[model samples]
Target: MAVYQALKTAGVDAVTIDTANGFRSKLKRDPVDLVFLALHGIGGEDGTIQKILNRFKIPYVGSGPQASSLAFDKVKAKQIFHRNGIPTPRYAVITTKNWKRILKNWQTPYVIKPVQEGSSIGIFFVEKKQNPAKKVEAALKKYDRLLVEEKIDGREFTVGILGSEALPVIELRPKRKFYDYQAKYTKGMTEYLVPAPIPEKLTKSLQIMALKAHRALGLRDLSRVDFRTDARNHPFVLEVNSIPGFTETSLLPKAAAEIGLDFSGLCLKLLSMAQNGSKEK
Candidate 1:
């Protein structure tokens, strides 16, 4: 509702449509100028709604259908990164048919997650002492396919992309084993250091790498690229969030604030970008 109120305060007749129920009928009844998608997870962020909007010739405030789909699927996104010469962790696909082979070939100290999930849902880290076979079997029962990714031993950081510019890098310090779903949403579980105190050179490099990942995915207006730097400080592109959260306290808005862009201003900027079909500035 933050985005909704922001638009209302900006003197625009904004209406909120819950995509769960009869949003289509509502759109037909009260056609709005643009759609500020605040939806998350499967049906919302996985290009389903974007494809619908494209069919109806409605302009939305995020990437197109192709980019949304690519960003939603971890396996496909990693492939795109590899094609563009973007550095990502080594990974392999695990299925019911190939689970045994993966277990024998792949090592521990890796992450197992569903291909198309968000907010770190269903993510598990198998350490050196733990047995990955059980986790792999159980996960395959729930999810059709999973990704086994080599874990990067280093600090975690995220770079928010606004238009063509990369916002300040924010280092994430989680109080848990890794930044899981709870650590991400719980108020005090994680600490975020904006404009993370790093050398100017490394910061700029992260920002540039984030922009390249965004462009490679054909994303527009806004995005958030996650990163993991090794012990040697070599940054690897984890994944890109094509449509990240937009609340006042969300990471993207927080980064934008560093550059003197307030919450309302950020909302309006994205809206303006969609309305004018503006490319990266």
Candidate 2:
């Protein structure tokens, strides 16, 4: 609803349509000149909506279908990041055959996540001496594929990319053991520090890496790159959010506000970027 208020505050003639309600056919008939994609998760962030917009020749904000597809898949995004010399946590793609062996030899405190889900859905952490069979079994019942990653134990941070520039780094401190679904959505569950209280050099390094990760995936317009920095000050890229949230606690708006850009102004700026076509090269 924040996006709605921002659009109204910006004086943009906008309408909301939920693709989840089987409104694809109805949306194609709408005579709107531009589209601001605020939808997220499976059908929306995974390129399905972007393809529909392309078929209708509708100009939209943020990355194109290809970029969206590449970034939405955690395994594919990690591969792209590694190939491009970007530092990301070590991970293994699991299947039925190797899943058992992986758990047997796996180190404690590892990270487990679904290969393609977002908003940290079906993500869990296995601490030292913890039996992961129950959690793994439950997740496998719902998802055929999963990613087992060596958790980067350190401070968490996120970088916002707009156009070709990287915004200020925002440090995240979750009150829980880790930032899970509840920590992300529940109010006061986490704390954010803008322009993270790290050394200036490290801040610049993270921003540069965030931009590199963004471009490597061919993402255009705006994106948010997450990270985990260790005690040694080494930062590992976690993942990229193609269509990040614009809620009251959203990071993009927080970074934009550092430069005096209000929520309504950011909404207008995104519309301008859409009209100008910040399509991936």
Candidate 3:
């Protein structure tokens, strides 16, 4: 709704359709110049809708089908990060067969989550001496695979990517134990510091690393790369959000705003990018 309103306020002829039901029919009935996706999770960000849009020869904002799929799957994204020499947290993929063996050797202070989930859903943080057996079993039953990652016990930050540029870094201070689904969505649960009070050198480095991760995943247009640091301030890429939230107060827009790009301007810029991409193809 925010994206739609932004486009409308900017004098762009935009319409919204329910991708859940009869979206294809609506597209056939009413063709639009471009698609500005504000979706997340499986069928939305996991390349399902992107693939469909590609088959229809419809240009859309954000990354392509392959990049979207690769970034949406945590395991695949981590693999790309490793191959590109990008620093990410140590992680292992656990399946039903090998979960027991993997968990047995895992260090205490680790995280368990579904391989392809967003908004920090299905995430469990196992602290020292806490029995994670029940959590692991519950997760395995729900998801085909889980990711066990070494916890970076330090500050959290995120960098937004716009076209070929990286926006200012934002520091996230979640009041909860971690930035879970609740902290992310609820008001006042997490405090955001734009341009993150870190040293200028560290900020620049994080921005560069963010762009590297974005390109490494073959993502274009826009993305948000999340990071966590150790006590030594060594950064590790957590994951890449191919289609990040698109609201006025969303993290990406907040960063863009610091660089003088307002919400409506950001929306128009993305629309123009999609149009240019359509012409190129």
Candidate 4:
């Protein structure tokens, strides 16, 4: 709805597509000027659709295939951040065979999550002494790899970036134990605080870190960077969402609003960015 309204307001006709079949049909029927990718999770944000768009020579919003792929895999993302000296939570990659070995060395209160899934789909917190190793093994049995990270205790904040500029920070207060899928999409489950109640310096630092992470992964147009500030107020990057949620109540939209950019304006700006990029190439 935001993208449709934005394009209409900007005097540009917009067409929405869903599923692989629909996308293929649209490509066959019309020569599209640009694609405002608003799809989230799995096929949308996990680089599958981006790969197809690239093959079709379609100019789309958000990051390219490589960036999208790297950003979606939390384990690989943390590794990239570590190699680049970007601060992220300490994590261990768990495989089915070596689950016990990894669990033996894991610190207390760690988060176990699927490597590639997003929207907090398969994330769970495991306590120190709980023999959830079996649970972790069973959970990871479906996937070849898993990510177990030392849970950082602190406030959850997200920074939205428009091009290279970082918009205002939005704090997420999850009603659940953590910001799970339910807390994310369900109404009245999470509270979003604009201009997150943090010191100016810390907020600015988080914005800078978020922009760095986005650029590090080569994200284009817009992206949302999630972080958790430790007890000492040091921020740690969780992951980057190249194609963030765009619902009226989404965090990126809220942050954009805080910085004086309405939903339509934000979408239009993103479209313009993609259009300008295509012209350059």
Candidate 5:
């Protein structure tokens, strides 16, 4: 509702569709110039819908199918980041069979999360002395794999990228243990600090790392790169949000607003970028 309202305010003729029946039929009936996808989780952000749109030769806002898929899966994105020498937390991927074996070797306080799920769903924090193996193994019975990452204690920041330009960083301070699903969407559960107060050099470094992560995944139009600065003040890339939320209070829009880009203006810019076809600047 917020995204549509923003786009409408921006003078873009946007229409809403529900994937109840199928998007193909809707696309065939009412062909669109481009799609600004707002769907979250599973079938939406996991690249399934993007692949379908690509099959129909439709140009949509945000990353391509491969990039979307890679970003959606936390473990795979971390692998790409590691391979490219991008700074990210040391972690291990766990399957049900090897969950115990892997956990036994990992140092804790660590984060155990669903590899492909988003909105911070199904995330658990395990302390140093606790045995996460059994619990993690039980959790993995419901999912294919899980990502266990070293918990970096510091501040959480998210960088919004419009094409190749990195927007100002937004620092998230959640009242909860971590920025879980509830804190992200529920009002007043978190405090967002736009243009995070960090050293200029560190901010620039973070921006560079974010752009590298974006390009590594072949992301297009826009994305939000999350990070955590450790005690040593070294920033580590957490994950990339290829299809970030477009709600009024969403971090991307907030960061854009801080830079004098209003909601409508931001929407228009994204739409224009999509129309222009990949000349990111």
Candidate 6:
């Protein structure tokens, strides 16, 4: 609904198409000049909607089908991150078959989460010497696959990429243990510091690393690369949110506003990118 209002405010005649009813049926009434997808989670962000748009030769904002599919899978994204020399936390995949012997190389105070979920859903942070029996079982039952990753003790920062340029860093301080679903929403639960007070050198390095991660996954147009800087001040790529939240207060928009691009102007800029973007892969 926020993106819808932003598009209208930017002088674009945007249609509100709810996928719950159906995407094709919503567009059957009139021809769409462009498909500004704001769909989240599985059906939209996992390349399903992108493939549908490609079938009809419609250009849309955010990433293409391959990149969206890649970003939705944490394990695959991590593999690509490592392959491209991007720093990310160490992780091991777990299932019922190897649940008992999975901790051979893994230590306590680990972070366990669903392998393919977004919004930090099913994320568990175990403390020192704590047994994660219930957490492991719950994650496996829910996601079928879980990633037991080493927790990075550090400050959290996010780098937003608009077109080919990386925006300023935004630091996230969550009231909770980590930036979980509750901290992300439920206003005042989190504090965000834009142009995070790091040295210019570190800022430039993070921006370059963010662009590397973005291009490694073939993500284009717009995306945000989340990071965690350790006590050593080393930045590790957490994940890339393709088509991240777009409200005036969302991370992406906040970063854009730092450079004089207001909310409505940012909307128009993204729309212009889609207009000039290639419809055919």
Model number with the top TM-score: 3
**Candidate 1, pairs of clashing residues:** none
RMSD of each: 1.7, 1.5, 1.0, 1.5, 1.9, 1.1
Give the alpha-carbon lDDT of every model: 0.90, 0.88, 0.92, 0.86, 0.86, 0.87
Score every model by TM-score.
0.97, 0.96, 0.98, 0.95, 0.95, 0.97
Candidate 3: C-alpha RMSD after superposition: 1.0
Q: Which stretches of candidate 3 lie over 4 Å from their true place?
A: 279-281
Cα misplacement distance, residue 190 of candidate 6 (Å): 0.9
lDDT of 1 by residue, 1-281 (tens): 99999889989888888887888888888887788889888888889998888776788898888888999999999999999999999999989999788767777788898999999988999888788778778888889999989999999999999989999999999999899988999999999999898889989999999999999999888999999999999999999998898888889999999999999999999998888782321
Extract clashing residue pairs from model 6.
none
Q: List ranges where model 2 is wrong by over 4 Å.
A: 278-281
Candidates 2 and 4 compared: the better one by lDDT is: 2
The worst-scoring run of ten residues by lDDT in candidate 1 lies at 272-281
Residue pairs clashing in model 2 are: none
User: Candidate 4's residue-wise lDDT over 48-79, tens digit each?
Assistant: 88888888888888888888988998877888
- Summed over model 6, clashes come to 0
Give the per-residue lDDT of model 3 (tens digit) for 1-281.
99999989999888888887899988988887789999989988988998898878899998888899999999999999999999999999998899888888988999988899999989989999998888888888999999999999999999999999999999999999999998999999999999899999999999999999999998989999999999999999999999998888999999999999999999999988988976432
Model 1: lDDT equals 0.90
Error of 5 at 122 (Å): 1.0
Estimate the lDDT of model 2. Answer: 0.88
**Which of the predicted structures, 3 or 5, would earn the higher lDDT when compared with the native?**
3
Off by over 4 Å in 5: 278-281
lDDT score of model 6? Answer: 0.87
Q: Write the per-residue lDDT of candidate 5 for residues 1-281, one digit (tens) a residue.
A: 88788887767788887886786888899998887888888888879988888887777778777888999988889889988999998998888778777877887799988888888878899986887767786787888888888999998999999878999988899999999988998999999987888888988988899999999988888999999999989999999998898987789999889889988888788877777883331
Q: How far in Å is the alpha carbon of 46 misplaced in model 3?
A: 1.1
- Identify the runs in model 6 with alpha carbons over 4 angstroms from their true place: none
Instruction: State, as a TM-score between 0 and 1, how close model 2 is to the true structure.
Output: 0.96
